[model samples]
Target chain A: MARIKFSTLTEQMFYTLLCLKEECCGMDILDKIPEMTDNRVNIGSGTLYTLLEQFCECDMIRETKTEGRRRSYILTKTGREILEKEYMRICAQAEDYRRFFSGDK
Target chain B: MKDTKRRIELYSFFDHSGIEKHLEKMAKKGWILQKITNLFWVYRRANPQNLKFSVSYCPSASEFDPSDSETKNEYNEFCRHTGWNYAASGAQMFIFYTELENPTPIQTEPSLEVEAIHRSVKKTIIPIYFILMLLAVLQGAMFVTNLISDPIDILSNSTSLFTGFGWTMLFILFAAELSGYYLWRHKAKKAAQQGEFQESHGHKTLYCVTLLAVFIGFIYWIISLIINSSYFELTIAVIMLFAVAALIFLVNGVKQFLKNKNTPAKVNMTLTVVSSFVLSFLLIGVVTFGIITAAKNGIFDRESQFYQSLYLDSPPLTVEDLLGNEELSDRYITQISGGKAVLLGKYEIRQYARSGDSDAKLPGLEYTVTVVKARFMYNFCKNHLIKNKDKTEGGKVIFADHYEKTDAAEWGANEAYRRYRSANYVNQYILCYYNYIVEINFDWEPTASQKSIVGDIFS
Candidate 1:
């Protein structure tokens, strides 16, 4: 049973979790990430495949259906919790930056 | 004739980057790699095209599997869906090529690729290379010990010397190859952490040079066999071939054992390694026993006709001549060593004597006479013994002298030759008579009269 090793989410990991909020096949997530990130981040198929395997192994994602080699996965409850925690962390950092800017003004 | 051709080339097993580059070059030249065999890569001619090749390692892939299983096929299909077409595979390595304008890389995640390669290396190359290096080191230690104890014996045994050198070269090559892969992996990991791909470095030049050296050594070894065409050499060649075959069989056995997917990979890997080691020990034991048995029944049997045949056809002075008018004292004669080849003949005899018949002749007069019939063999024996005498015989430095006679007929010898004392062991001499080299060692310094007698026997 591997716990999430990363203390903080990488951009790809965060965006991938964001896309999996709705049930989506692996290939679709690859396509959706670029559109969602405004082309700032592009996840290669190999990266997505490996990350999906790792996520499934860590119980962060579960396969809902498999049509041929195309697999559809949804974020597990554990995955949603981790994603929410990461979102809160990013929000706190943004809040600190805002406070610093206002103090300067 | 088939439309395709096969080429035999030597490449380091772990040289993924170099291999992909080479395949790409070949593709441009219209040669498409179709399959890989033990020592060759089969290729089919195709229209020249620009192709990108990617090599990867899968721990589950095996050399023993005759056909791809369902899982392997599915894996290949998965890669195909991504535009990477499977080209060839060997052991744990897989190669894929694509002509697509924009092809998805097979290994997008560097860390995962690194882990896969690590697993494959651990399962295959590392264990075998480590064991071979250990054996090479052990062999080198043995050679040093032997040279120290009996330099003369090591000089006479060229097979062991060359074998030791060959093993040493292989060990160095393996070390270079292994370390190159390790350093590449380390750098690759660091680059991957920065979201960059690092190509695996391959030692193409080192691999080529080592292979060329081995090829030349193999040819020289064969020439040596032909020059020294003795039954002993024949037996040794047979044993060597058997050992090589047994090793291949043992490796295949491990691969076949690991093919059963029911067992965990870790457990399978452990079992494969343990069994390979045990079977290798068994192989060594069997080969050693065969060699010892052949040696004992063949050369060491002084009474054997084959051993007796190496002696002189006609001797001017026999054992009886040496006894002279003195009492018989003590006499012991052993064949000691003997070999015969197409152009060379070798015979060694160790004889002991004492002035009295009692056993008090503890370190009595000992004679070690070695007779070699051919020029090459004689020269080899002479040079090695003389050049290494000081290092091999470690004791008080006594005296050394040498002389040559251009007029051999006047000296009562058949041909012109030289004689030298390596270091005073009482007396140690390397004397050439006609085409033969006759080395004589004695416990007491020989007088002029005794020297003439020995020379007369050769003449």
Candidate 2:
């Protein structure tokens, strides 16, 4: 069975959405992810470009401004809800891991 | 020294791994990627360096997009920020190279990469391939129908055989490419789900072999046409080839001219397609007019007269021979035409009085000799020949024409059949020998002695 797109956010997708929380240039997200993760999580430009387009198509992101070839985008309200759900899912996974390892029910 | 080179590469549209490795190898050999088009890839001479290459697909991009389009520029800027320099792009595919030893790959997420490639393929190669495969299937069905209904004509005609072989090869190539891509995509998607990138390979060798075979077949077909066709036929063939070549060159020229002018993709595409159809019809009209004018001027007639006189091989059995009148030898013209292929050879001889002859109703003789080169084809040749004249309507037999068994001893053959049209016996007889099938038609009822003469000559 095929999974619904973006139902479960990938690591790159999570960071990309996190970067879009504050209005930023589309190209800046490529740099912001590495800086936010301390060089741990990096997204390819091609992958980022495609993701941005897809995000815009699904209304998860919308164009805010365009200067020359550089464009800015911000996460929509729908995008924030999905991002919050993903954050909760990750938190639940972490909670489960701690409970199992720390011998706490 | 030539600073640039061009090569015809057959890499699949979705075979990014293959294209990346190939570009890397070329870079190490002192050739830097320059440009790519549907026809060929161009490379420029450069210092030998170990370069890392990546291929990424932009489904929104088109081949006719302006070189400096904002979307492409923004995409390029994004790549440049990561130390990847744009090399060249064709259609929806972009190639980027980096001097940095371990620059982040252009496509990091495997699922997204696969999706991008699939989207790009859908935009370009898939539809074209699907249309071509449909054409191949249609041609293949027609060829098989002809083979079953009129085996002798198809087996004996070089053009038919060549076209059949070409279409079959094309179908095989398309099927292999389509199936290979789908299978790879399936595996790639599975790997992508597990966060692994699956490398893709193209059937480059299959492409090369199929193209070579088709080229050789085309050359053989041309040679056969020259040898077997009349002067008028040969001229028309040459004209047709030139017209097709000119149409392709002109259409491509128009597209390139439009591209150079930075025409928008939709306008460019529409104009290109419209021009192709317009140019094709124009060429056809020109060829048809030229042929009619030449015919009116008697150019083909004079040439055919000269050609006919030069290469008239003597027929084994002639009207004079059947009539036993040596004096009639000078009255009739004997024309022979045939073609030979690997499976069989077929030749037809027609002897009739010349057009200007005083005797308009001189008895004529016509016969076709089929030499089955392979034993397996003997039965097929014989069966089709026997049922060649059967009439049908809408795939159903309306009037059944058959052959009645005749005595083989008199004709000195293993088997013989006299043709019957709706129970009326005709003067045509089909004789089957060890490796030969002969169909002879007599203008007048042939005597027993003439039948023996045909059997003696053909058997």
Candidate 3:
């Protein structure tokens, strides 16, 4: 079997997965991303659409509903696992920086 | 009323961003592109508005595919959901446009977009360029060999000059365009890796100029050939050009036809190749038949004024006319033949006067008469003669003793002479005459009889 394509998630990919965790419409991700990151992470509609398709192909996300031209997707078990792992990695990195600043070996 | 405009379509092969920018600017000018052809881009009048245009290259998007193909339908649906309206597509390029202010770009992932462009260019552009470069190299090698064997012929011949110029220009343009694509791709990839979108800045000016030059050269070459060559040659040239064009279309059509059937790509490719080869073989057969028919009809008859004047009647001067001896026999041969109306006064005749017996180890003569009608041609020939005055010919420094004489009322209006002799051979020459220059080379000093023959011919 092919290995998971993106071993490390880009900022857009991470945010896209984060938006899908709530079972959101694909187009809504474009707006929710900027709000979720306080306007710091803005995912273009194209990025959202492409990421959703790739996620579906890799079983990381599944489309839950379609209305006309709109599609809504939710994160899968695999997607949740990846997101949790990324969150833990980020926390561990912050912890190391915190310890270093506190003069702990 | 829909106002339409047509402008020549000129763009570097891989300048997607530049094309988008151009389209956006045109939209602002109230002209939106409707169609593009090999020659021109057609545009329709539209309301002036700020719009965003995006171009994406999809290598697998076959031009021959039906407009509503599943792949196209899926792509259209995806873009529509994002409010990116489908505009137009040609070959591997798909265009989208939207009037939304700050509308999302169609390609947001820079690295994936860059990779897609790279893949498309490699699939479509690289192989054609490789073939073009290979042909240019082969033609260049042949040109160099021809120049080496007979520098004079290659320089003086209009066909050779035109072909050589065209091929060299094509080679340079191909090299520049190929390298330009790769260089842009390299820069774009690096910029993409850094999470930046790099707009394509290509050799647009150089590409346009070279394309124009090549187009002009091709037209001029064809017209010159028709004007200056024999009917037979013109027929062959036109047929060759048409056959090549037809073969290219046939091959492309076969591939596209196969693709439209949704055949497996590998099998379709193989069938396209095999069918094209078979059809090409048939084309060769047709060309051969045409040639044979032309010859049978005496369409290649060489009955031009030059041929009639030069060969129908015995030459005013010949080997026998120039030299008279019972033991030293004479042999005559015509070196060059054929003429056209456009080449009226711009003509040269060369003849060889050799001993009858090759084993006898005797002297020979080379006679040349060049009628210089064109001023540039006259200057070129004069310069060539002057520069190569002491050049070795037939293992002898023939033109070493160059001298001028005005009193050649005996030979012609003016005269130049050179004479050289060695143990095994003698090469002596006098290039003299009126507006038409005559050159005579004798292996040994001309006998008294030969001297009078030269005077008689010029007179």
Candidate with the greatest TM-score versus the true structure:
2
lDDT of 1 by residue, A1-105 (tens): 434464567777888889999999877776788799888776655456657776887888999987776678999988888888889999999999999899788
State the lDDT of candidate 3 residue by residue for B84-183, as single tens digits: 7877777667778887787657777887677667666778678888799889988988999997765445654557766777788888878887888888
Off by over 4 Å in 3: A1-7, A15-85, A96-105, B1-6, B38-40, B63-66, B249-272, B302-423, B426-459
Candidate 1 displacement at residue B391 in angstroms: 18
lDDT per residue, candidate 2, B37-130, as tens digits? 7687999999999999999999888877765666678888999999999999887888999999889888899999999999989987899999
Which candidate, 2 or 3, would have the higher DockQ against the true structure?
2
lDDT, residue B142, model 1: 89
Clashes of each: 0, 0, 1
Q: What is the TM-score of candidate 1?
A: 0.70
Task: Give the C-alpha miss distance for residue B253 in model 2, angstroms.
Answer: 1.6
Identify the superior model by lDDT, candidate 2 or candidate 3. 2
Which digits, one per residue and each the tens of the lDDT, describe model 1 over residues B208-227? 87777877766766665555
Candidate 1 docking quality: incorrect, acceptable, medium or high: acceptable
TM-score of each: 0.70, 0.89, 0.72
Off by over 4 Å in 2: A1-4, A102-105, B302-316, B324-338, B349-361, B373-376, B387-416, B420-425, B432-436, B452-459
* Whole-model Cα lDDT of every candidate shown, in order: 0.67, 0.87, 0.68
- DockQ for each model: 0.29, 0.74, 0.30
Model 3, residue B365: C-alpha shift (Å): 9.0
